[model samples]
Target: MHKKVLNRDRASFFVITLPALLLYSFFYIYSVVLGFYYSMTDWDGLSRKFNFVWLENYGKILKNKAFFNSVTVTFRYAILMVVFTIVIGVLLAVALNSVKRFKTFFKSVFFFPAMISSVAVALIWDQVFIRALPNLAPLFGVANIASPLGNKQLALYAVLFVNLWQSLAMPTVIFIAGMQSIPDELYESAVIDGASMFDQFRFVTLPYLVPTITVNAILTLKGGITSFDYAKALTGGGPARSTMLIGIKIYIDAFGDTPKFSIANTESVLLFLVIALLSIVQLTISSRSGVNKA
Candidate 1:
């Protein structure tokens, strides 16, 4: 009877999860396998008959100056986004959590940007930078206040600023939750021990939030790497490709006039590897920090 019930339970669980598992396998696993194969071939994404040229796509990426530039821009955007978001997120979270009045209102205000679609956010900022700023510049007696998307020197920074604005809410919410989850007694103890707020944060609050930081790091890494919609909607990889991130480069390679599907696949595979490596490195650091704290 026990064995029969156990088997029935297993069957029920599998039945419940079967649809999702099947979808995941079909969409994710099969697609990855297909992409990997395609990455080894010279498929033009149009011609049905394509030749398999192993490792050539990968080798080509190394020598491609445009691809190298895209990588540099991506890393620059990711680092700036991650650092600014962490600092601003923690500050906002701390303030919002500590406040007594209008806390709910402030939270909603800060998170409202996140509720907006990325495309919409980008468009809105695009208008501000391209239309409004230029017009307002003359009023302020400022010269050359044009769209950063059109200026090679300022395009990347413009994209970074807009992306940062759009990406803050989730991390702030997570930091707030982390702060709240910490026991009140810890803060009280620190207060009694004559520790100021900064000291308390360093010793009590910061230590407790390490796991949250790890999760946010991974989230930011993913966000930074695959950031396409905002960049596309805002800059469209313009001003001589100054703002062209690797994701944009992949899209252009895959879909542009000369659609190099295999090259796109190669870029995709490299991106996946990069993300995986960064994730592992973050996990290692987090684990080591946990051990040291223990």
Candidate 2:
């Protein structure tokens, strides 16, 4: 009877998960396989006849200076995004967790931006950068520095700033939960030992929150690397392609006026490999650190 019950439970679990598994396989796994096949071809995305060019697409990528520039921009954006988001999120989380009044209200306020569509956020900020800031600049006796989004030197950072407004929300919530999970007894014990608040945070809170930070770091890093909507809508990879992220470049290569679907797929494959490698390295390091801490 126990054996029969175990079999029944396993069957039920498979039944519940089968649909989702099938969908994932069809949409993601199948698409990736197809992309690999297409990457070796010279398809213009709309072509009926195409020739397989093997690794030629990737060879072209190596010689493409614009592509390399996009790579540099992407890594720069991702690194900055991950650092700022984690640091700011932790600070905001710590502040909100310590507050006794309207804590829920503040969290909601911060989290609200995450609910808005990235394209909508871009549009809203574009207006602020174009119109509102210029109008208010004179009041502060500051020279009207018009449109950072139009300035090649500042466009990338401007987009990063907009992304942070939305991306900080989830990480902050994660940090808050990590902080709250620490038992009150630990704080009391620290106080008994005459440890200052800073010491308690550095020794107790941070050590305990390592796992949470790892989780947030992976998320922020992935988001930064794959960011496309804000770049597309806010700057259009403009100011002479200064903010042309890898994702955006892949998109334009595939869909822009001179479509090169083969090149785009090759770029996509390279990006996937990079992301996979980074994720593995990060997870390995984080696991080792966790084990050492334990």
- Reference-based lDDT, each prediction: 0.88, 0.92
Estimate, for each residue in 191-258, the C-alpha lDDT of model 2 and write its tens digit.
99999999998878887788999999999899889999999999999889899999999999999998
Name the runs in model 2 displaced over 4 angstroms: 291-294
Residue pairs in candidate 2 whose N, alpha carbon or C atoms collide under 3 angstroms: none
Clashes (backbone N, CA, C under 3 Å), per candidate, total 0, 0
TM-scores for every candidate against the unseen true structure: 0.95, 0.96
Which residue pairs clash within candidate 1?
Answer: none
Roughly what TM-score does model 2 have, to 2 decimal places?
0.96
